[model samples]
Target: MNKVKILNLEIDNLSKVEFLDTLQSGVVFTPNVDHLMKLQKDPEFVQAYSVSNYKVCDSQILLLAARLLGTPIREKISGSDLLPAFYTHHQQNESIKIFLLGAREGVAAQAQQNINLKIGRNIVVGSYSPSFGFENNDLECQQIVEIINNSGATVLVIGVGAPKQEKWICKYKEQLQNIKIFMALGATIDFEAGNMKRAPKWISQIGFEWLFRLLCEPKRLWKRYLIEDIPFLLLILKQKLNLYLTKDYLKKNSKDKRHSWHTAGKY
Candidate 1:
């Protein structure tokens, strides 16, 4: 399992085909520019990422950054793309039962319906759309867990958002003893449900999908894309010039060293 170092995270250096063919059972977290920026100051998010089995590149900008830094990633495996590929790849595998969690009301259900129709079978067995701040309510979290458990789903695809989605999975994965795979894919459920349209292939290829999203929901994503995440480019420049303090970043993450991403073994 070779890895490409991108700032604080080490992304798996696996192509889409390689990953889809080999991955069996483990947690997957796709890191984008916003996620990287959050990781800089969000200790809880860092802790959640520490326990993940896979951290793959989810942003085309990150992929380009990797190339600029002289260690190119094989591909960009965004959550929106990964989810569809995953379901289609395992369409015939009866054991690959999935549960859709997150998105707005009815979104996950709609995604389940669409995916089932595409696969010609019910690959997505269950769906749930948690309420606002549902993660903070212990009882609600437990009830949702039970619902997923009762649904008999082996794979859990959660898409509430970053940090929240990752942290929730990290906290409750143990309780989900029946689940074999956990995927924290932001907004993918919406894409599958057709509630949101993805950027055109050409736009995505040029690494401007963030602009497309910002254009779509300017009020919601402006700060994320234009304001808060601005430091990512400077950090990439620092890395390229060998000015990034890797030691300091590692020291910040040292608290979670006890958790090993490879403990469950690779596919």
Candidate 2:
């Protein structure tokens, strides 16, 4: 697979591009916003997937990914970048076939309908609502995999929430090898499905989407947003500080052969 490059982001494989292009052709890419934010502070996390030829980016990356289809370049972007790309792709009639998975009962269907209303009909291929704890069931897992495989979907968007969605992709990657793009979209399916509401555009722009979500589901999300998020931020800060300190130390101690000349030859 060829690598696609856009700005600082690089897509290592063309399989996803080819698949989407052949199916929907010009659909915008949408990824998990939270994951994108995490990647900004943790390049290692981004690189881990990047090296695997996976483009784990947000909306912006999706936009760039759409543009680089069949082109020889890398695709890298964020959520903010996807809106415009979607519009452009829509105008070009190159939309990709999307499959929405996860979320509450009927949420996937609702999300698909909403996206179709927003992006147009046929943009979404299908939607499925799995068992609440589908991840733990091997039989259910195989069943879902079979459904996805038979769907001939170009992009399979999993919204079963984190770690689980990620784990599912890792476990089924081999079985779904024919799948070009497999995104673990976390709550996006729920948000789209209307099971949850997304923050207003202004709030999202200001990076307060988490706050809005917490406001909507205070009892369920307060701990995660207020407590877990804070510690996560702190950990990110610590990691950054350590990286800076390490770089500074390396620079300070780096060998300078010119300054270490030996003058003891005469002795």
Candidate 3:
């Protein structure tokens, strides 16, 4: 698959369905680290964002991070590479107003301040950190929608961490019409606020970014990487095998169907 452009974001070819599906069904899929590493090597995988709904799989998000880290714009880059890219893009082109949602109390404020300090002025249009576990409340969700809509932000960056962040974006993408791009960047706020440490360049380049993160926050992330990462990789492999088999079966079936049509016409 080739990369397609959607609203200032470059998405890899393998993710077209996932991106489109998010637009229609609001269900975003998360891609693994390996796919992200592969995307970085392929220039054709770059995408530009427009007015359409853009949903980036997890792998694509990591690839964006890698690009920013490899080309550091400022001496002080955020722990999560995603923030630097977002910040850098905004700094270069201040045409878009951005909204920050979903971080610990004051984390968004800290991030906003950091961006202002780093970029020499405030680029963030609005920043809000909902109460702990606010996703569970319908009112909170509505309030968030209202805040974003009223702020007139073109992009909304959510840092609620996965599954929640992904789910929230999918669920609310429609209602949040003012925002052109909605990115669910996990823990990017903390990283930007200097609350966390990003992996070293060598670790990121070697695709050991996850390992570095685990070492830094073992108590929180050790179980996730140690237990979930392997199973996740296995599942992705299974999906790839299934796709290959399906493609072969479809080709064979089409050939047989053509033959059957020819025979029937002859008879």
Query: Which model scores highest in lDDT?
Result: 1
Clash counts per candidate, in order, are 0, 20, 7
Q: Locate the minimum summed-lDDT window of 10 residues in model 1.
A: 258-267
lDDT of each: 0.88, 0.53, 0.55
For model 1, state the Cα shift of residue 49 in Å: 0.5
Candidate order by decreasing TM-score: 1, 3, 2
lDDT of 1: 0.88
In lDDT terms, how accurate is model 3? 0.55
lDDT string, candidate 3, 1-267, tens digits: 344432223444433333333332222233344323222222222111122233344442344543443421112122255446555655755666678886778889898888878887567888999876676788988999999999877878787764456556756788988776666667777778777776777766556777887788788777656754444344334443443233343345444443211111000
Q: Tens-digit lDDT track for model 2 on 1-267?
A: 454433234544433345334333211233333443333333333333442334534433234333434343334333223322443354345435667888777888997888878775667778889876676678988988888788766667777654456546655667865466566556777766667666676765555666776788788667655654454344334443443233332234343213211110000
Against the hidden reference, what TM-scores do the models get? 0.92, 0.61, 0.63
Candidate 3 Cα deviation (angstroms), residue 193: 0.5
- lDDT tens per residue, model 1, 25-127: 9999999999888777666678899889988899999999999989999999999999999998998999999999998899999999999999999999999
- Candidate 1's C-alpha runs over 4 A off are 246-267
What 10-residue stretch in candidate 2 is worst by lDDT?
258-267
Task: Name the candidate, 1 or 2, with the larger lDDT value.
Answer: 1
Better by lDDT, candidate 3 or 2: 3
Model 3 pairs whose backbones collide: 5-48, 6-49, 7-49, 7-50, 8-49, 9-49, 10-47
